[model samples]
Target: MTSHNTFHKVVVLGGGYAGTLAANRLRTRDDVAVTLVNPRPEFVERIRLHQFAARTGDATINYRTLLGKGIELVVDSATRIDANTRTVRLASGRALEYDYVIYAVGSTGEPPASVPGAVEHAVSIAEFESARRLRARLDALPLDAPVTVVGGGLTGIETAAELVERGRAVTLVCGRALAPTFSASGRRYIATWLSRHGVSVLRPAAVSEVRQDAVVLADGGVRPSALTVWTAGFGVPDLAAASGLRTDALGRLLTDETLTSVDDDRIVAAGDAAAPSGQPLRMSGYAAGPLGARAADTVVSRIAGTEPAVIDLAFTGACVSLGRRAGIRQLARKDDTAVNLYIGGRMGAAIKEVTCRFVVAKRIRREADKPGSMSWPKGGPRPAGTVSPAETASSAGEVASP
Candidate 1:
């Protein structure tokens, strides 16, 4: 056991928005040593992944410019966390001992296996490597090739627009409606924008099977698709459950209001991988930064022998980019329900671009340069009532921001 005078060794899992900021924020305590573990050598701007896939923008930045001095970067994947032993087992067989562990593995797009041929034929835009493979595939196909985007969420809309701008013939096969998370007005705006931009918008349609070169709808109609992009559902890594820790239905670490794990106070959670109070905020970069900082604060408080603060972050809004020159920003209540107000067209596009850049360049990088300097809006109304862990696990899937 570490003595009171010994420095606290903190190991942060996943170098996404939450994990990166949490690692930097831990620097606020001189007695803490921060080590960030990630599977990649670079920080991926997940928000700009659609642009990256379309070759419209770059999405990766070398970690040298994003991580703070004295912070160790472990280029390895965490296979499991042995909480009882206070050790993290890596895929490479190396084990890391830590005084406290921060779980922030982020989220991913997982196509449902029930749909035949989806896993083999369709590509996902939820991650860096996946986007890279998508780009390569798009490069190999002719611009006029028929491309189908499945899912009507923000990610699907953004991907469809990006591909259209690259001169590809695009069809958006939305399961229910376009921009389902946005306000009614926002959805109307997206539908009109996409329709006017030469995109064939198919709504309230379900894909029964994803074939090699076509998608068979539930009604038995087939749509020709040279390439299929799946952005339907988002899911977290099973690391928490795999490690014998309690997790929500989505596999997010179960945490208290303070972001401390319900199963172990020595372990905290942040980002998309954390389900605080069993009612997690929508998995978005807008929420991830604040959650990261808060998770670090809990760790710092424990080391200082003080009471840790609970989560109080608020959701201001959600934004979706349409191609490179147009977009829409949907305002929302503190509780995340969309309001009537919104900004569309070129101005919306500019703000969307700025918000994406600020997340990494300013919010994350600044925290790395100046620890504990990041902050977010608070005073949002706390969600009332609670659901059983089993109930939460069976709830509907949550999609991260595009």
Candidate 2:
């Protein structure tokens, strides 16, 4: 039998906020060998994807800078996880064994399959490569091009505002009131900021179909657009479900409050891919990093023959970036209920910018330097009635499209 002090191997799938943090925090254990698997060589900061799509920022972080010295970086995609064999099969024909696995592939643009013609016509700013494609497409378009942004979430808001700030004729189609998750005051600030940036807002307007050059509204109204960017919602990878792991409807790996897999004790989940207590955790980097750390702690505790504690995640608020120069900060309670408090205009924009920077760079770097240095807001237990944005999109795999 392997002794408790025997060297243990851990493989982290996905190099996003959660996966990276999980791997970094695992460095503290000298007996654990950590290997991170990712498709790209550079870490794409999904949070700043809109800034990159707008040509206002660079979001690529080289693995050399973000990954710690003890973690080995493998450039590949995981196609299958064989829990029976305790191995992961890669697209590159490599098989990796692990004492524990962290599934944190995060999310990507909602597949264009949600709407007719969307796959063929609409563009997006959901990931690094997708944002690059959008940037290039925008660069080729004329300055006066009419652009339509779908969805009222933060991504939609930031994308429309960024384009409008660049002098593009922008319109946002919100199926409901803008920023539905935000407080009324927060929503007002965002609406006003977009208006000031010359972005036309369409509310209570539903899009029935996306065309080659426009979107068809549910009311049978057709709006012409030179380019349509779909920011509707996001969908996570289906690896967990495919691997026969217990997952929520959206394929998010199901875990107990301790972040341990319900089916396999050797497996855990974090970030956008984790569904703890049958509830999908918050999608933001703020929640993802801490969840990853918690997963690491759980696995470490198990290896050390100790009882692991349950997850304690709290949401402080949501920061909506209107553009490079404007934003809205919505304060919230522990359960993610928006309060009546908000900050807007340039001040909000600055705060949002700093927060993004810290999430993408500063915080992870600090944690890499000093393992376990990171901390997250842990309010009361997650309220039963409150559903996170991720859970709202959860379905029999028909999740929201980004």
Predicted structure with the largest TM-score when compared to the true one: 1
lDDT of 2 at 215: 82
For model 1, residues 1-402, the per-residue Cα lDDT tens digits are: 445468899999999999999999999977788899999999999999999999999999998898988899999999999988899999999999999999999998967787999999999999999999899999999889899999988899999999998789999998887887788898999889888889999889988899889999998999999999999888899999999988878888887778888778899999998887777888889999999999999999999999898889878889999999999999988877889889999999999999998998888899888999998889876544433444444333345482
Q: Report how far off residue 103 is in candidate 2 (Å).
A: 0.9
lDDT of 2 by residue, 1-402 (tens): 345468799999999888998898887777888999999999988878888888888889888888777799999999999999999999999999888998888887753686788888888777877788889989989999889999988889888988898899999999888888888878888888788778999999978888877889999999998888988877788998889876777678877677777778889788888877676665677788888898888878988999887788877788878778777778888877789998888998898888878885666887788877888788756535423334533333222111
**Least lDDT summed over 10 consecutive residues: which range in candidate 2?**
393-402
lDDT of each: 0.89, 0.82
| Least accurate 10 contiguous residues by lDDT in model 1 | 388-397
Candidate 1: global Cα-lDDT?
A: 0.89
Query: TM-scores, in order shown?
Result: 0.95, 0.93
Cα RMSD to the true fold for all candidates: 2.5, 3.9
The collision pairs in model 2 are 110-401, 110-402, 233-401, 233-402
Off by over 4 Å in 1: 1-5, 383-397
